[model samples]
Target: MRPALFASLLLILVSAPMTADCPCIPLTHVWVVKTCNDWNCASTELAVANGDPQVIAVPVGMNDSRWLVVRRFTAGAAVDVNDDSFQLKQFDGMDGAVKHYSGMTRDYHPMLMTAPDGQVLVLSTKQPEPRGRAVAH
Candidate 1:
């Protein structure tokens, strides 16, 4: 190959984005579950721009991870929540766990609460399936 053409090809190869071995799941929003004391509770369909930072007690011996519910926008507008799906994600330091919905329903809602020690507890009407192998990029 010509020197100039070879250099150009090398540059292209070097700059090209590396793709994952497996298909990546796009993660856009994160929802931290919180407990409600009364009849009023914050709306669940909140966007990324609004994050609730109210500190709650974490459970005993739960010194590491934070529980989160994640959502991906597969349709509609950027902030719209129509026809979207929710997944469970847990983060403990550098490692994390995720649970995907094999079949999600609108009635299945989840809430998060923290123990006095800062350990998070995930509560939901419907139990999530086994931890998922799928990962978000």
Candidate 2:
């Protein structure tokens, strides 16, 4: 019944991270989204919502290229991400991971990293760690 206790509970609930990437996120609808090549791309505020991650349009020849991949995670598949989830989750960037073609399976794409939480992290050809080419120091 205390006001302070109620306030503290509210703060904790507000700060919690939502499981948006689960059940494998989706692509934003056509026309409203942007890609890595656009010079006047929309800012974070005007960008797609968490429920709309579908790649509406990609850069020229970007789809088949091994350099970039935009996608959502699958249910129960943890993204297998870490504190660096920022770079991996960015909507556009060149520092992405390098998907190892040799490591890919017949059923799945080369970049899909399925974690236990149903998070499928679609890394690029420049991702760090097992995906990156550089030896970690």
Candidate 3:
């Protein structure tokens, strides 16, 4: 075999995307919280890796609350959220769609901003879509 041929083959193999045979795709964990009040009481945390997602939602009061949703996927997996993958969608408290935003992660942490009202949706596989929200492709 020629050295050039070997090098070309190696490059192709390296550039190829990782397959299921290799390992599970990376899992991203995002945490978003905001208070019903206007005070500085909002906080968010995000992390990404090869793991599972954990979503939790808790009601704060009779008319105010917060939701925590986890969206997971393979390292290179893409879900169709508002015609986009690896993105987040915000619904108007089970009503209309507010907006669509992409995930921004740096150093295994996502740089996502939290919202005050409505529900949050993250695109991932092996999970059911949120109620009253569009499903990812």
TM-scores of the models, in the given order? 0.20, 0.19, 0.20
TM-score of 2: 0.19
Looking at model 2, residue 35 earns an lDDT score of 34
lDDT string, candidate 2, 60-135, tens digits: 2333322222444343443434332212332232234223333544333334344323333444333322433688
- True lDDT of residue 42, candidate 3: 20
Overall lDDT per candidate, in order of appearance: 0.37, 0.37, 0.36
Q: What's the CA error at residue 119 for candidate 1, in Å?
A: 22
- Lowest summed lDDT window (length 10), candidate 3: 34-43
Models sorted by TM-score, best on top: 3, 1, 2
Candidate 2: where are CA atoms >4 Å away? 1-34, 42-117, 125-137
TM-score of 1: 0.20
Of models 1 and 2, which has the larger TM-score? 1
Number of backbone clashes in candidate 2 = 29
